[model samples]
Target: MRAITISEPGGPEALVWTEVPDPEPGPGEVIVEVRASGVNRADLLQRQGHYPPPPGAPAYPGLECSGVIRAIGPEVTGWQVGQEVCALLAGGGYAERVAVPAGQLLPVPAGVDLVEAAALPEVACTVWSNVVALGRLAKGETLLLHGGGSGIGTFAIQLGVALGATVVVTARAAKHDRLRELGAAHTIDYREQDFVEEVRRVTDGRGADLILDIVGAAYLPRNVAALATGGRLVVIGLQGGRKGELDLGALLAKRASVAATSLRSRPLAEKAEIVRGVREQVWPLVESGAIRPIVDRLVRMADAEDAHRLVETSDHLGKVLLVR
Candidate 1:
């Protein structure tokens, strides 16, 4: 099997393509012949040594992949060799072969290409866990997503719409038109406008019912300001520095809740649970043509560095995939 490795983490140039031993399925796992892998911001963070794979996970970086099952390990059933599936990974998605827990495998949705399926798992799980499961987004509620041009943001917009929320997003002006066509009821250009004011004006001073934040500390105060009374603010990333002061008084006055979580460090059981929820609630949406993965570019596996560079530059409106 061929895999990309980082001998010393730094930049996209650090990714090295080399022949590696083929991975074999372990008990309750399946060996997948990967066709495509989605490059995530976390992969970039891992490439720079800011984030390491969780304990007992593969050292190589890849968070999600789409492929065919080549073999199943003991105790795994109900799936066959050659089944088209995509999986969420703790690591090792940048390889030709990856061993995934059977519980993590999701069948490629109808009308979706097998390779494009690679883009679904991570974004689906992230949106479902935060926007749907944890935030309890309800019909007629407002869901605000930061980084509206991102893979996760695109998914969040579509899923929030399909699930009956009035979706609002913050991105650059260049991306707002596309986001609007994708079902964003409101769009704010974070660089040119204050999102807090824009959101308040658009919502008639009521504020958004839920906010999915990826900017981390830099947006904390604004996020607090954008939330309606009793709203939920879920922080999923800290692209800005992690340290920030919070207005506990404001939170108490509004009876709001603030929470943060990352998918990678979660225990296997919890991750499996998220996967299951996405498979049940969200996968069917893809199958029914209500939603699908948004792929902006595909590069050869050997040129994963280029894909990483695209993601790092924030030039992608959707996922950048590496195909083997």
Candidate 2:
């Protein structure tokens, strides 16, 4: 099998495409013939040695992939060879083949191409786990999503809107129109406008019922300022610096809840639960076209380094896929 391996853990240039041993499925797992994989910020961090894979995880960087099941492990059931599946992996998704737990596999939705299904697992699970499961965004409420052009952001906006929430997003002006088209009731150009103010204005100063933030500490203050009474703020990434002062008084006054989490590094059973829930509640939405991944570009598998570079530059909107 061929994989994109980190040469020395530095920049994207360190990614080297080379042949490696084929992976065999372990008990309750499956070996997938990877067709495509999603490039995520976490992959870049791992490539640079800033982030390490969880215990017993593969040393490779990719966290999610779409492919066909080539072989199933002895303990696995309810699946077969050649099944078109996309799965959330602990690692090793940048390879021609990856072994994944059967519990983390999801079928390609009705209308999704196999390659596009590669973009679904990570973003869908992230959005569903945080916005839907933790933040508890409900119908008729106001939901604010940061990084509106990101893979998770695009899904969050669509899901938020489809669930009847008034979706609000912060992105560059160039991306604002697309955000609106995706069901954002309001779009604020974070570069030109104060997102806190725009959110407040659109929500009649009551703030938002739920806020999904990827900016980390830099947006912490504004996130608190933009929350409605008892609002929930879920942090999934730290694109900005990781440490900052918090307005304890403000949060106390609004009775807001601020929590941070990561989809990777979670226990397999927990992730499996999330996969099950998403398959039940959200897969139908994706299948019916009410929600779909927003793919900005697709690169060849050998150019995984370039995909990482594109994501690091933050110039592209939505998922950057590496197609096999």
Candidate 3:
């Protein structure tokens, strides 16, 4: 088997696709022959040595993939050797083969292409877990999603709309039309507009009922300002920086709450639960054509450096995939 290994943590150039030993499934795990994998910002951090794989996880960068099951381990049932599935992985999706916990596997949704199914697991679970589960965004509410052109942001926008929430997003000016087409009620250009003011204006000064943010420190104060009374803010990415000072007075006045979470570091059972929720709630949306994979482009697995570059540039909308 071959996997993208970090020769040294530094740049996209550090990701080296080289031969490695084939993975064998352990108890309750399955070995997947990777067809395609989603490229994420976490993959960039891992390539730069910032985010290491969890203990006992493969030393590769990908967080999700779609592939065929080649082997199944003991204690795993109801899955076959040749099943086509997409999996949520803690690591190792950037390989030709990966070992996945059976609980993390999901069947490819009925209406989605097998290769494009690679984009669903990570973003679906992230949005479903945070935006729906934690934030409790409901019908008639407003969801403000930062980095709207991103994989997670794009999915969140559609899901929010599908779930009957009015969706607002922050993205580059050039991406606004596409986002609006995807059901964003309003789009704020972070480079040209004050998102906090725009969000408040769009929501008739009540502000967003739920805010999903990726930029951490740089946007913390503004995120709080853009939240409606009793709003919930879920921060899943620290692209801006890690440290930020909270305005206790503002948060208290609004009765708003903030939570920061990461899927990669969570326990297997927790991830499985999230995956199950996505399979039941989100998969139906995909199958019904209400939500679909938003792939910016697909690069060959051997050209992973280019894929990493595309993600870092933030020029692409939705997911960039690495195909085997």
Best by lDDT: 3
Tens-place lDDT digits, model 3, residues 73-114 = 999998999999999999999999999999999999998898
Task: Provide the overall lDDT of each model, using Cα atoms, as 2-decimal numbers.
Answer: 0.92, 0.92, 0.95
Clash pairs (backbone) in predicted model 1: none
Worst 10 residues of 3 by lDDT: 195-204
TM-score of each model, paired residue for residue = 0.99, 0.98, 0.99
| Regions of model 1 farther than 4 Å from truth | none
Question: In TM-score terms, which candidate is top?
Answer: 3
Q: For candidate 2, give the lDDT of residue 316.
A: 90
TM-score ranking from best candidate downward: 3, 1, 2
